[model samples]
Target: MGKYDPLGGYLRRLKTDSVDLGFAEIERILGAMLPKSAQRPQWWANQIDPQGRHVQTRAWREAGYDAFPEAGAERVRFVRRQV
Candidate 1:
């Protein structure tokens, strides 16, 4: 993995109901700026990457969480699942 796979690390460390983080905060965790696509709604869909080698949503799902980006908002929320 990259030096800063925020989703993986964040999901691993989640121990609360949810986490609300702005793009800047996420970027900090990622150690890099997000791509322009990351700002689009489609990018938040739980889909596979073009290469199909991995599921884009696997990390959060495996961590028993779901992620949602609020419409017209500047932050994304990662909510824990009850299981």
Candidate 2:
């Protein structure tokens, strides 16, 4: 499993349609520090690379959520995607 799979499972199990989490909270769930690129909003975008390199994005997307990073708040809001 990929490192971010843990996060996917966590999100998938949530009953709420939305969750707001700090970066530190995510690291706690991941047990690994996010990359420096994570500071950029683009890093949390719901897009993917052609080679499937964006594993983190895949994690949330697979869990039926979309991540939206707060501007300069060091937080992210995950909204469950509509079917």
Candidate 3:
């Protein structure tokens, strides 16, 4: 593994939080959060469900506990679980 891995030590340095935001919104936040010279971050795998929840596969939408759009995106905020 490398320093840039999701579970790597570098990730701990990210300015993350647990807040609600739409997919598009989270995308913008991630763009701002990452270092300009590093590889782009990607959404955690557990949050996505290719054959299950459609919202997880697509953009964010209001749906009960799923109300937290940031939970499904790669952004630091709203991260339910880490790699």
Candidate 4:
């Protein structure tokens, strides 16, 4: 399984249009620590690199969600992407 596959699985199970979770909570779901890059907003952007380096993006996007980090907060709000 991919490192972020568990996160994808988690998001796929949610029924809400949006879900908010702390960094710690996400770490728990990931069973791994997020990279320091996670502190930046761009890390949560929906775009991905050509090398597919941003596995986390594949996770949420495939699950039909997008992550929005609350500035100055340790939490992120994942909104279901509009189809």
Candidate 5:
């Protein structure tokens, strides 16, 4: 499990094609404000740790979801993978 496992667990409990949540909602799950880097696209990319494991991306992928930021919006949209 990674530090962001809470986000993954929340995503797993959702049953929908997509969900749009405000930064506040995400912070609620994270129990803290998002880092400034989180607003950057690179932060969402699959980053590898020194142990050769994906950090943030592992959470969503494990929950069968992917998150994308809406252009000019303050919310993030998480989409479920098509089976």
Candidate 6:
């Protein structure tokens, strides 16, 4: 959740359906995973290629990477939304 300091607050707002309309998609995806007590939240990691093309991390997104249950003790938790 680096550079995502506001993400936790944003997620809290989103879970209660208090998010602005611009965050609709994010809300929907997280909401769909509500049944799982422990979820691997998805992340949008940006990468710049040698050609300067910005690419979002599709693999992590698809895998629903978990920032919680953690890879290890040094891991960081991500924002959670009810969306």
Candidate 6 at residue 14, lDDT? 39
Output the better candidate (1/3) by lDDT. 1
lDDT of 2: 0.94
Query: On residues 1-61, what C-alpha lDDT tens digit does candidate 5 reach at each position?
Result: 5577899999999878788988789889978787777777666654445674547777777
* Candidate 3 lowest-lDDT run of ten: 60-69
* Candidate order (lDDT): 2, 4, 5, 1, 3, 6
Please give the TM-score that candidate 2 achieves against the real structure.
0.95
* lDDT tens digits, residue span 1-83, model 6: 32222333344443332332223333354443222322332322333245633222322222333223233222333332222
Error of 5 at 39 (Å): 1.0
Model 3 clash number: 0
Ranking of all predicted structures according to TM-score, beginning with the best and ending with the worst? 2, 4, 5, 1, 3, 6
lDDT by residue (tens digit), candidate 1, 1-83 = 75335666787786788888897887888787877876777766655467744454666666667778877686888888787
Instruction: State the weakest 10-residue window (summed lDDT) of model 5.
Output: 45-54
Residues 1-83 of candidate 4: C-alpha lDDT, one tens digit per residue: 99889988999999999999999999999999999899998889888666998878998989999899988687899999898
Greater-TM-score candidate between 2 and 5 = 2
**How many angstroms is residue 27 displaced in model 3 relative to the true structure, after the best TM-score fit?**
2.2
Per-model TM values vs. the true structure = 0.74, 0.95, 0.23, 0.93, 0.79, 0.19
Native-to-model Cα distance after best TM-score fit, residue 3 in candidate 5, in Å: 2.3
Question: For model 3, what is the error of residue 75's alpha carbon versus the real structure, in angstroms, after optimal superposition?
Answer: 12
**Number of residue pairs clashing in candidate 2, backbone atoms closer than 3 angstroms, sequence gap of 3 or more or interchain:** 0
What is the per-residue lDDT of model 2 for residues 1-83, given as tens digits with 9 covering 90 to 100?
Answer: 89999899999999999999999999999999999889999999898677887879999999999999999988999999999
Task: Please report, in order, the local distance difference test score of every candidate based on alpha carbons.
Answer: 0.71, 0.94, 0.33, 0.91, 0.77, 0.32
Tell me model 5's lDDT, rounded to 2 decimals.
Answer: 0.77
Give the Cα-based TM-score of candidate 4 against the true structure.
0.93
